[model samples]
Every structure is written in C-alpha cells, then in structure tokens.
Target: MKLLKQIILLFSVGIFIWACGSSPINNKNIEKEEPVVIANDSLEYEITIIDIGFNLFLNTIAQPEGYYSQEYLETRNRIFVTNWNIRARNPSQFNDNIYENVIDYQPNIDYGYDVNYKLFNYFMFAQRKYKMTLGAGYSRRIR
Candidate 1:
C-alpha cells in the first residue's frame, strides 16, 4: 500500500511538471490576468495477480517454475474552454488548445514444468474541463 501511494504521487508530480513546461502566447495589452485553461479525459490501468498456490499441477508435477502475467490500459480525451478572464475589448483575445488521448499496454508470459501467475501494470490520467463517456460493447473475436 505504501508503495502504491508513492508511485501515485510521483506520477502526479511528473504530469504537473510536464503540463507547466509549455506556455501559450499571452496578451500583454490586457491589464488584468487571464483565466486558466483546463482539459478533460478518462484513463485506467490495472493488473490483478492470481495465486497459483500449491494446487498440484494441471498436467505435470515437476513443480511449476514458470508464470503468466496480464495487463490492461485504456483512455479517452476531450477538449473545452472555460473561465475566460477578458480585459481586452475583443473576444478574439481568447487562446485555447485541443484535447487528445494516448493509451499503452504490456503483458508477459513465462513457462516451465510447473506454472505460476503474477501481474504488472503502469498507467495514469489527468483532465480538468471535459465530459464523461460510458458505452456498451459485445465481446467477440474473429480471425
């Protein structure tokens, strides 16, 4: 649990640094401060490790020396503009950016006379001003 907390903090800080690195063009003529920009998105990454215990063996009894791991990662993103602090007379003074999404995944498998199981996952997400999306899907595989 402690490790998970630290990892979450580190990931959050890294994202903050990355977001602050870029600055859009500012309107010097505006006598007041401009509003902050915000974006939106959804993301998830998880790994569930199932125990192999000492359930004997499916087909062999050489004491499984191998293992299997599975992982999943998904994300969705959208764009928006809000809190436009305007000092200039022209509405054109607004400056905004678009939103997008990126996803990643990794899985590993190891085999031996006896078998085991483990899992590994790495993923995070951040969004400020956007919408939430949920949908339904059917499961099928065609080759």
Candidate 2:
C-alpha cells in the first residue's frame, strides 16, 4: 500500500513539472508574421503595421469581416485613435514603446470598410497583446 502511494506521488510531481514547462508545443511551431498594410488607393492613405503575432490575432481572434457595420467601426476607431494619440504624445505617462507613433485618422475622410476594419482589428490586437486599455470607456474584453 505504501509503495503504491509513493508511486502516485512521484507521478503527480512529474506531471506537474511537465505542465509547468516554459515553452509550450504550439509556441515552438509558430510561424513568422509579415507586416500588414492597410491602404486605400482611391483615398491615397496608407498605413503599415509590423508586429509579431498581430497577423495571427487578426485572422484567428478578431470578429469576421462584415460582423460590424462600417459606421460602428468608425465610431469605435475615433475613440481609440483619440486615446492612442494622447498616449503617444505623453509618452512619459504611458509606455513609450507601445505608443511610438500618433495615428493620423481624420473623422471626415472616408477610408472605406476594409481600411476601417483592419485598423480597428489592429487596435484590438494591440490591446490584447500589451494587456493595456486604449479606450477606457469602451469595452476591452471582447476576446
């Protein structure tokens, strides 16, 4: 009886150690991500985002295209961009690395659905990856 208990204890410890290993199998097999460009040729606006795992997040985690109306996306983007720009300007108060550049998103100009959708999803990816809130009043727990 004592021997069986000892064997079970060792097995439990081994399983625990294996579970707590630093690198997971999925992380080891991750593919490299390329920069994603958000552009509107007709409007002559372009933005390139180069961040690791953003592509994966965009495709796998974000809501599907057409899940949100363009107007809704634009409204949320306006709020997010305003807060992001504020952080970018005041780097001392926020993480300088995260808010490196200010986005030039004009409220009046129409960027079309693709541009707005990609931009909004990028903001969502950034929020999740950095674990920081871009728009405090807006919901950040989508995922």
Candidate 3:
C-alpha cells in the first residue's frame, strides 16, 4: 500500500513538472503566426480645395423682412468652421472605394423681438445636420 502511494505521488510530480516546462499549444501557435500588415502602395491621400464663396453670397440675401439690418444679418449668418478627417482602405484588387469623414452644419438662429420695451428671447439651435464636405465647387458626389 505504501509503495503504491509513493508511485502515485511521483507520477503527479512528473506531470506537474512537464506541464510547467512546456509552452501551451495555443500560445505556441500564436507566436508562429505572421502578422498581417497592409502596405502603403495602394493608399492615396489628397487635400481637396474648395471654393467656399457661395455661402458668403447666400448670406447677403438671407434675412427676415422689413428694415435692412447688417448687424442682425451678421448675427444670423453665424458661420461654423469645422475640420474633416477622411480614411479609406481598399485592396489592390478591389474597384470600389469607401468614404468616411466628419461633417458639420449651420447654427440655427431663432430670436424673436417685441417692438415694445425691447423684450426678446434667443433660441439658438442647429439648422442642419451632417453636411459632407467634398472640397471645391458645387460639385455633386456619388459613391
């Protein structure tokens, strides 16, 4: 009985030592795998120039009726400047392109005034949402 117990103890210790010395099969496979990295050969980065003068001209005409007010018009024409970053990835064998970028919208102005005693309230909000910026001209984009 004592001999059998000693043999069982030795077998368990051997198994523990073997397990501690050997690397796990999952870890070994992961180490052997080659990392997938895309080369920059097919990537194209471009900065687009836009003719942003149309909005300025449109500003000259946008106003409520009655007396012509420059100050009021300027306040109404609160132009919001925004930056856009676009990223696209496609393989060399693919013909289609993907589009992604940040978008901006004009700020909405809802201010009503009472002629008597100069009572007023300004409710500012966004007029539009997510205007995709395709630089230059009044060009239409289809993707």
Q: Which numbered prediction scores highest in TM-score against the true structure? A: 2
Q: What is the number of backbone collisions in each predicted candidate, taken in the order shown?
A: 3, 0, 1
RMSD of 1: 24.3
lDDT of 3 at 111: 26
**Per-model lDDT:** 0.25, 0.89, 0.31
**Which residue runs does candidate 2 get wrong by more than 4 Å?**
1-31, 136-140
For residues 1-143, what per-residue lDDT tens digits would candidate 3 score against the true structure?
A: 99999999999999999888857886776455533221222332222212222223223432333353534433423321222212222333322232232222233422222210011001011111123332322124311
- TM-score for each predicted model, relative to the true structure: 0.17, 0.75, 0.24
CA displacement after TM-score superposition, residue 65 of candidate 3 (Å): 51
Model 3, global lDDT: 0.31
TM-score of decoy 2: 0.75
Model 3 residue 124 CA deviation (Å) reads: 47
lDDT of 1 by residue, 1-143 (tens): 99999999999999999888745443342323332212122223332212122122222432123432211112111011111112112344422221222222222322211111211110001111122111111012100
Per-residue lDDT of 30 in model 3: 49
Winner on TM-score between 1 and 2 is: 2
TM-score of candidate 1 relative to the true fold: 0.17
Identify the runs in model 1 with alpha carbons over 4 angstroms from their true place: 23-143
- Runs in model 3 deviating more than 4 A are 24-33, 39-143
Per-residue CA lDDT of candidate 2, range 84-127, in tens? 99999999999999899999999999999999999999999888
